[model samples]
Target: MSKKNEVSFFDGKGLRNDGRRLDELRPIELEVGVLDNASGSALIRQGGNRILVGVFGPREIHPKHLALPNRATLRCRYHMAPFSVEDRKHPAPSRRETEISKVIREALEPVVFTEYYPRTTIDVYIEVLEANGGTRCSGITAASLALADAGVPMRDLVVACASGKVGGKIVLDLNDFEDKYGEADMPVAILPHLDRVLLLQMDGNLTPKEFHEALDLAIEGSKRIYEMQKKALRDSYPIPDEPQEEEVVEVEK
Candidate 1:
């Protein structure tokens, strides 16, 4: 590795390149109801990543053979635009995209009340407008919000976060540079209200102790994000204030 790459992840003060503490996440912003055409849509920006998710259906599933007998089948597509990264990605879906799509579908399936809409399909589309790292986790986060915005009944919202080891220490929400050169990266998703783990995937190696630490950190980060997700949904529907009673209207009449 070049000298710059060697010391690129951390400094003598034990802070990451972006000046975040070991357990600190990148700044996150989330919004819902962004796409007018979709039944439900959401967007999330975390660090340098930008992801949009749109949810459509509990609509009839064409190719009837694919329909579930007793529950709605969930389909997810995760795609990155050609300009999403430094090197333009191919427009065609890659093996990685295929795998992440499946991962996101599974991660969300548990929370959805598919039984209520049997013989239908719930389609989730995740588009990565930009990527800096941890796109899978970010995609899951936004996709769940889109599902809620679409008015899909669910047990609870799903939230996700990632943790990894860099420069001999674990860190929360690894950016692209740390993820590329760090020792390990683990992304986790969960149903926050039910306290259920929906998805956990790790890339790279970590000791048993380090793995536990990373998992705990990621979970904490996810819970924090869960609060933000709730706020975004709440903001979309502002409760109208009650109208004030007119005073002395009888005198005017």
Candidate 2:
């Protein structure tokens, strides 16, 4: 209830520390099929967060016991580079990363037509090249695009975004500073075409009204991101120009 040692997140002029409005999101850049060797890949930059996602398979599952009888199993691995954050993290997978990987897989499974590839497995790997905040949501966005680029059949593309309460005001897309100091944070993913929520997670505290407002802001942000994702896929494969017919050379012949 008292602002003491907290950093000044908002100025009197209604601008955040990064100079964005409460409802404004950081700039986002997306590219699909970025990796040549992988079946499909995508890279995304949101503010200072950078994530690369690779999708492989629909191939036979190894260790046979892990294979599903009715539908393709979805496996995900979310990792952070040792230098991704200010402090170097261990190269090995941490518990947090494992949990995030599981959540991401569940988030994507609902949209994928896994039944079409029974007894197979689709693997998605997400690597955080740089992390300022909201890596999980960004990873999910990248993974979904990568899956689509890999030619995986899906009901719809999944889009994700986060909204949080910073300086006692609801803000869309929290940066590292906001995430560290914000009172509440919520990350959500959705199937834009179906208007169905695929993932939702929250931390800290919020009232009923604030909760709905934050959720609405996140949904709007995801819709904007959806457009960029589609554009990236389209840009990856440009249409070739039609060849022009040569004029008749009857006289020469």
Candidate 3:
């Protein structure tokens, strides 16, 4: 087997190249109702990644055949702009985009009360204006806020974060450089109030012990992000009772 490249991800001072501690998450900024036209919208900036999500629906499905008979069909599209990354990508949807879209949808479906709006459709559009790494997790975080902004009936808010192993140490929230060279990446999503796992995906290898550590770190990061999500929503509209999914206020923005 070929030898792994020798790269220094952490400095002698125990800080990563980005100057963050192993268990520290990158900076995050969130905004709600950024788009005036959409039923609901949210923008998130996590590290160097920027993702915007717009939610539309609980409205009638376009083609009659696509609508679910018993519950609302959740349709999601995750698209990264051609200029979003270092290397310019094509405008068309790539295979990775397709996969992430499906992943986001599945992660979100469990919380939405689709049964409330039978035969309707809830459409979510995620636009990645920039990507450094961990866009999938960031996307889920923003999408959940957008759904709340749209006043969709949901059992709870979903939040996500990623942790990985780099340089033989597990770290929280991998950046692009670390993800590209790191030994492993695990992105996790959960319903904070419900304490249920909505999504968990891993790439690369880790020992059972390392896996548990990484999962714990990711959950910690997600809980922090969840607080921000609630704050952003509250800033836009009053949150009478948080995590009490039934109290979601319908935002007109």
The positional error of residue 195 in candidate 2, measured at the CA in angstroms, is: 1.0
RMSD from true fold, candidate 2: 3.2
Superposition TM-score, candidate 3 onto the true structure: 0.92
> What is candidate 2's lDDT per residue for 1-253, written digit by digit as tens?
4552457888889999889999998899999999998889999999999999999988889989999999999999999999999989999999999999999999999999999999999999999999999999999999999999999999999999999898789999999989988898899999898899988999889999999999999999999999998999999998754432222444346
Off by over 4 Å in 1: 1-5, 241-253
Candidate 3 regions exceeding 4 Å error are 1-4, 238-253
Tens-digit per-residue lDDT, 158-218, candidate 1:
9999998887788999999989888899999988878889999999989999999999999
Candidate 2 Cα misplacement greater than 4 A, ranges: 1-5, 241-253
CA-lDDT, candidates in order: 0.93, 0.92, 0.93
TM-score for each model: 0.93, 0.93, 0.92
For candidate 2, give the lDDT of residue 153: 98
Candidate 1 vs. true structure, TM-score: 0.93
lDDT of 1: 0.93
User: Any idea how many clashes model 3 has?
Assistant: 0
